[model samples]
Target: EAGVAQSPRYKIIEKRQSVAFWCNPISGHATLYWYQQILGQGPKLLIQFQNNGVVDDSQLPKDRFSAERLKGVDSTLKIQPAKLEDSAVYLCASSLDPHPDRNTEAFFGQGTRLTVV
Candidate 1:
């Protein structure tokens, strides 16, 4: 099966600017997630979608970060007025929602690396 896909594997932007990342999950998967992975830290859940409906986004910083998975297939994440502390890897993962805990075997893409100056 095709795996998750992300773009602009690397990016460099100045602080207070804006940047966006994209993701395409595997086919037939019903659950998608976005995570921010800072250097030396594990992936932190940012946003989660289940069939186009938001399941979890409590960890997302609404002040500067936003995301959408309109059709439950492809998704986009944007960071406006970026900060120096925002430099990190944005990882997208997808899984088939087949369990009660909503935890399926998620597949990760080669994340987008952002560098804020």
Candidate 2:
């Protein structure tokens, strides 16, 4: 009955510092996703995971951003040497299936707002 969970609702750091965010998806969900949303822009898919294996990560910035879904349950996203452009909301979502045509709707957690100074 519980929804997805995310930690550290807000974070602020200097441009060169590193930050990490955590997420725990709902039970029975098989598809988990991480998104980035800058102000005034729609969320952009950064990565997608089907269970513990990565399904997509083409949009993720390998230079500084990384994510992982451990044990097909909890997930973590990290940004090292953060840039000013990294200031945005990091959203975690999950669905019962991976196909976009499926009827299942993704449930989102309270996003982590990152501010890079």
Candidate 3:
């Protein structure tokens, strides 16, 4: 199976600007997730989708961050008016099921590193 794919391995923008990132998951995978990883910190779940429906997005900054997985295959995340604190690595991951269990392990993409000045 193909691994997750992400575009623009790096991005730089000024505060209050807007940027977008894209992700493509493995074939036949029905679960996808977006996470933000700050330097020296673990990945924080931002949004999760199961077959095009959002399963969780409690940690996502709704005011500035938005995402969608329309066909349950690929997803996109956008940050509007990016803040200085938003500079971090955005990672996309996928698994066979949306729920976490002992059997499934999420595969991560290389990630897009965002830098806000």
Taken over the whole model, the C-alpha lDDT of each candidate is: 0.95, 0.94, 0.93
Q: Write the per-residue lDDT of candidate 2 for residues 1-117, one digit (tens) a residue.
A: 999999899999999999999999999999999999999999999999999999899999999998988899999999998999999999999999967688679999999999999
Which segments of model 2 are wrong by more than 4 Å? none
lDDT of 1 by residue, 6-55 (tens): 99799999999999999999998998999999999999999999989999
Residue 111 displacement (Å), model 1 = 0.2
Compared with the true structure, the alpha-carbon lDDT of candidate 2 equals 0.94
Indicate whether candidate 2 or candidate 3 has the larger lDDT. 2
Candidate 1 local Cα displacement, residue 77, angstroms: 0.3
Task: Note the residue pairs that clash in candidate 3.
Answer: none
Q: What is the lDDT of candidate 1?
A: 0.95
RMSD to the true structure for each prediction, in A, is 1.4, 1.1, 1.2
